[model samples]
Target: MDAVEIKGPAAAFGPRHEDINEDANRFGDRYSIRFVGKDKVCTNLKYKDKHSSVSKDVSKEWCDGCPERDGCAYFEPFNQIKNKTRSLTAPHNYLEIFPDILDQWGDIEVVLIDETPWYNIFEKTARIGAHDISHTRSALRKLDDEDKADSDVIKRALSLLDTLSAGLSDKDGGERQADRAYELATSIDFDELTTELTKIHDGRVLEGTDYTDAIVAIADNLTEIKQTARWASDQGIIGEFDSPPEQLWGVDNSTKDNAKFELRWRNVDLMEIARQKPVFVLATEMPTESVEAMFDLPVVTVEDTVTPEAEIIQLNSRMAGITRLRKRNQTFDNLVEFTRSLFGSRLLVR
Candidate 1:
C-alpha cells in the first residue's frame, strides 16, 4: 500500500503576500492600543505586493459565525493561528492581552516579534520591530537620567575627554612629546615617583613621604629649568632642545621666523615658566643622587645660610660638571653660546 502524506488544511499555511495589508493594518491597531502614544508603528505594506484578496477570502470563512467579527478584520484561521503563536513567543504581550485593562493603565509595555509568519501575528496584533526609533529614544533617555544623577562621575568623564581632545588636536611630534611630558609631570603620583627615584639612586629610604610630595618636589625643580629655558628662548638666547644648533638658548630663526616664534610662545611659555620657576631646585634635604637623576644634571646641597653669590657659584660648579660630560660630544655652537649667556659665565666653565 502507498503511504498517504496528508497535508493539513490550507488555512494552516502561513500568510501569503495577498494577506499582508489587512494583516498589517489589523496588527497596527492592536499594537497601538498598548504602544500608540509611547511608540510608533511601521509596516512593509508596499504596493509591490498583493495581500488584500487572499486576506478577504480567508476572513470570510474563518470569521463567518464569529461574534467578534466586527472588531477584527484579519482572516479567521490566520488570526487564530497567529494569536496562538504570538501568545507563546511574546509572553509580555500576552501578559497585557486584555486591551481594555491595558488601556486603563495608561502606560503599557509591548514587545513586537520578528518578521516571520509566527511573529507577523504579533505584528498584526502589536506592530513593533527591534529597530523602532521610539524604543531607542526611550533607552537613551534612561541613560541620560542616570548620568545626570552623578555629577562627579560626569565631571571626571568630561575632564578625561577634554584631555584626550587636547592630545588629538596636535599632530606635530614636538607638540605631542611636550604634551606627553606635561601630562606625565602633572599626573604622576608623587609616591610612585619617590619609590622609583629611590630605586634608581640606591639612597637611604625617606620616611613620611608619599608619591605626590616627591613628584611635586621634582616637578618644581623641572619647572624652574623649563622657565629658565623659556626666558632664554624668549631673549633669543636658546633654540629648541631637539633642533639644529642644539643651542641651550636663542630665538627660532626659521624662514617664517616671527610666525614660528609666535607659534612656539603664546600663553604656554609665560604660564608654564611662571608656574614652574619656584620649584626648579628642590629642598637641600633631598638625596644628592636622586636630585641629580631628577634633573639629569649634577646637584649641590647648600645650607639655608648660604648667600646668593654662593648659590650662583654652586650652580656654576654644577654646570662645570655637565661640561665634563659633554667633552668630545658634538656641541651646537649657537646653542652653547645661548646657554652660556642665559646661565651667565658659569655655563662656560669647561
Candidate 2:
C-alpha cells in the first residue's frame, strides 16, 4: 500500500463485489469476494420474452407530442430525442482533457466497469400519460382565491404551491431538490387542484384537461399518490402518468444478472490473503480533494510500523492536482515487481 503513495499506481476501492457475477468475471481462488447488503434471490424460468405479453395499457397521454405517437414505447421515442443531444462524459471527455496520458501509457488501459449492464428484477415503471404542469399551475392559482383556505393545512399547501411554482421555472437539475419539489407540487391534493380549475355548475374541476381526472381519482390512494409524485420527478418522463405499475417484467440474459446468485454474492471470511494465494486486487485511481493542511490525528505522530525492506509511497500537497493520477493499464504484479526492485524482496499481499 506504501508504494501506492510516492511512486503512484494511485489505487482506490473499485467496483463493489455485487458488480461481478459468473457471466461477468472468473470464479475460483484467483478472485476474492466481498459480500454486502441484503441477501435476496430470484429466478426466471418460465417468463417468456414476448411483445404480446406487454399489453400497452392504452396510455394515450404519452403520445401527444411524440413524433411516433400513434403507438410508441417510452424508450422508442426517447431514443430519437436522445440522438439529437450529446454530453461530455467519461473516456472520450477525459481523453480530450489529458491527451498526453494516452501517449505516456502507450495504449495501456485500466478498466472501470464491465461492459454488460445489469437490471434489477424489481424495476420501477412509470405510467405513460399526458401531463400539463401549466394547467396544474392554473388549478393552484384558483385555490389562492378561495375563502375556505384560511386553515393552517390549506395555507401551508398554498405556500408549498408557491415554492413549487418557483422551482418549476428553474431548468437546472442540480439546483438542490427544486425539480423534485416541482413534481411533488404537481401531484398534491385534489382540493388544491379543484380550486384552481374553472368549476362547472355542479362544482366539478374542469374536465377537458388530460390530468384533471387522475387528480380527483387518486386523491385518496396515498400510496399511489406518492408513486405519482415519483413518476413526475423522473425528468426523462413527461405527460400525465399514473403511479408506477405493480411490476415491470424484463429478462436480462447477460451473465452479469443471470448468474448463480450464491456464487456471485458470498461473504469475505478473511481480511488478509495468504502469501501463497495467487490473487490480485483491482482498485481505481481517483484524484480526490487535497487538504491544504492537516494535524496528526489524536495529536500523536505515529511511527512507521512496517519493516525497512518495505518502501512507503508518499502523497502530499505537491501531488494533489488532477495530473497526479490517470487511468492506465496496470497490474498488481507490476506494482509488486517494482516494489521488490527498489526495496528488497517483500510480498505485496495484505
Candidate 3:
C-alpha cells in the first residue's frame, strides 16, 4: 500500500499462498492491486457451472474468442504492462516457472522481493524410471506402426529410449559411470526427441484417452532429463566434491523389476538471474565470499546490527552445559522445573 501510494507502481513477491492471500486482503482493495492466482488465470473453471462440461481445448477456444482476452490477466499481464500505475502481486515461483514473465511485465521502478529467491532458483533432481521408459516405448512402437509418414522419427525416439533404459539397467556391466551417462544423454539429439514427443503429446490429447495426462507428464520428464543432462555435463562440476563418480547420474535399484535413474547437479551458477537486474539480498550474516561464490560478479556488502526495542532476560543453567547422554533424566527434570518456575501456576504454554 505504501509503495503504490508513495511511488508510482511497485510489485511484491512472496513464497507462499498464505502470504499472497494476506497481502491481497490487506492492500488489494485499497490500492487497486491485483493478486494473480491459479483460479483467476486458468480457464478450466470458466464454464464448470454449466450442465455440459467443455473440454480443455474448447475452453481455450472460448477464452480466445472472448472480447477481453487481450487485457485479461487470465491470458497475460496485459494491463499491468500497459498501465504504469497498475501493480500486481504473485508468488516467487512464477519467475522460475515462466522465465520471460519479468520481461512481459514491462519496466517497474521498484520490485520488492520479500524472502530469499535463492532457494527457488536451485533446480531439483529429475528422475526417470524403467516403467516410464518401457511404457512410453511401447506406446511409441504402436504409434510407429499406425503412422507411416512419421514412422522413422518415432522409431528413432524408441531407439533412444531403449538405449537409455539398457544403459541404466545393465546389471552385469556394474554401475554406469557419470561420463557414460553424459554419453547416453548426448548420443541422441534433444530437438529430434522433443519433436517426436510433441507429436505423441498432440495425438494423445486429440485421442482424449486416459493416458493423455501421462503422455504430457512423460514429455515434461524427458525435457527435464535433457535439461539436467545438458546442465550437469556442461557445468563440469564432476570431481569437484569428495564423491565425483556418482554425482551426475545415480541409479536406484531398490525395486528389483524397476530401475530409477536420477540426474543431479551439485553446483550451479546464478549468472542468468544476476545479469537480469540488480538484486539486493537480505542475508543477515552470510559471508561476502559465499555470496560471490554462487554469483560470479562483483558484489558489495553492507553490515549492520539490529537492536530490539523490548528488553530481554536470560536464564542460565549449569545442567544445560552437560551432554544429553550424560544425564538424560536429569535434563528433562531440570527443564520441567525451569518452565514451572518461569511462569508459576499461570497456565503457561510453551
Candidate 4:
C-alpha cells in the first residue's frame, strides 16, 4: 500500500502483546502490509474531486462521496436528515444545524432575504391601523370615565350650594359678605382645601364651604356657650365648671378688675382668629418615619461582585453575533420580520 490505513475498530487499536511476537517472527523487525491492488481498488471506488472535497487525501474524498453518508454511525447526519428534522421543529426551523455551523466557522451569519417588498408595505399599513384602533379605544374609555366623575362632582357641588343658601336664610348680615363667603366656599379650588383639611381632622366631617365663615361662626358660638355654661355653674345655677372661672377670661384679679379682664379676653379671641390660620391636615400627616427608613437602607455598589469569566465570554460571543448580523445586508422587510419574530404581532403595532 502507498499509505498504511486502518479501518473499523482496528483504527483505535494500539500495539498488543501478540503483535510483538508476530513482528519477531516476521522477516524484518519493522513489519508492514503491502497490497498490490490498493491503487486499483481506490480508483474503482467512487470519490469526490479535489475541488469539491477540498482535501488531497483519497480516504477523505471517498468518505465525502459515499452514498451512505448519513448512515455512518460516527458523525452527524447529512443535510437532508437535518432538513427533515427542522420541518418537525415548528416556528424556529432554521436553528437545527446552526450550532454545528457556528462550531465549524466560529459564527453563523443570518442574512434576511426579502424577495417581496410588498409584504413590508402591507405590514406598515396594518401597523398604523392597529395603532389608530388602540389609541381611539383608550381615549374613548378615558373620556367616558372622566365625564362620569365630572358629572358626579358637579351634582355634589350644586347640592352644597343649596345647603349654604338655606343656612344663611335668617342671618341679618351684609349680602356682599355672604356673596364673598359663597364665592370662596363654592369655588372648585376649595375642594383641594377641604380635602387637605379633612386629612388633618382625620375624617371628611367638613365640607369645602364649611371652612369659610361657617367654621368661624361655629368657633364663636362654642366659646359663648362654654362661657355662659361656666358662669351658670359658678352661681350654682348648673353643673360645676371643669376649669377655673378666671382661666376662661384669663382673669386672676378680684371682682373689681373683672370688666378689664373680660375686654382683654375678647381681644384675645379676635387675635386668635386673625393669627391662627388652619392648614390641610393630609399634607401635614405624611409619615416621616417611613421616609427616613427609606433613606437608611443599604446601597449597592459596583465593587460588590465581579463578572465571571464564562459570562464575559458568552457576552462577547453574543456581541460578536450582533455585530455580524448588523454588518449583513438587510432590507426593511427583514428588520420587520425579525422584530415580528422577537415580539410577535405586537412588535409591528408598537
Q: Write the per-residue lDDT of candidate 3 for residues 19-108, one digit (tens) a residue.
A: 465655565542444445423454444332221122345456656666656655544544544565456565554434322444555554
- All candidates in order of lDDT, best leading: 3, 1, 2, 4
Tens digits of per-residue lDDT, candidate 1, 198-312, equal 3322211122111111222333344444554454454444465332121211122343312111112111221121122111231233344433333334433433454565322
CA lDDT for candidate 2: 0.28
Top-scoring candidate (lDDT) = 3
lDDT value, candidate 1, whole model: 0.29
lDDT of each: 0.29, 0.28, 0.47, 0.27
TM-score per candidate? 0.16, 0.22, 0.52, 0.12
Please tell me which model should have the higher lDDT, number 1 or number 3: 3
Candidate 2 local lDDT, 1-350, one digit each (tens):
11121121211122324433332223222222222211111011121121111222212222344354333332331342234311111211111212332223232222111111111111122221123234434444455566534344444444544443443343442133333333454555546444334242112211222333222222323344344334333422324444332222111122432211000110111111111121122121211110000100111111235788754545488764444432222434545555465332211221
Sorted on TM-score, best first, the list reads: 3, 2, 1, 4
Best by TM-score: 3
| 1-350 per-residue lDDT for model 4 (tens digits) | 11122121110111223222232233231222111112222332333122121112434555567675554432332342333321111011122223343233321112111121211111110011122223323332343455532544434443433433432342432233333433433344334323332232221111111112222222223344355445446535445764323222221223331211110111112112111211011111113322112122221111113446322223356456655555554633465665455421111110
Off by over 4 Å in 4: 1-167, 171-195, 198-213, 216-224, 229-350
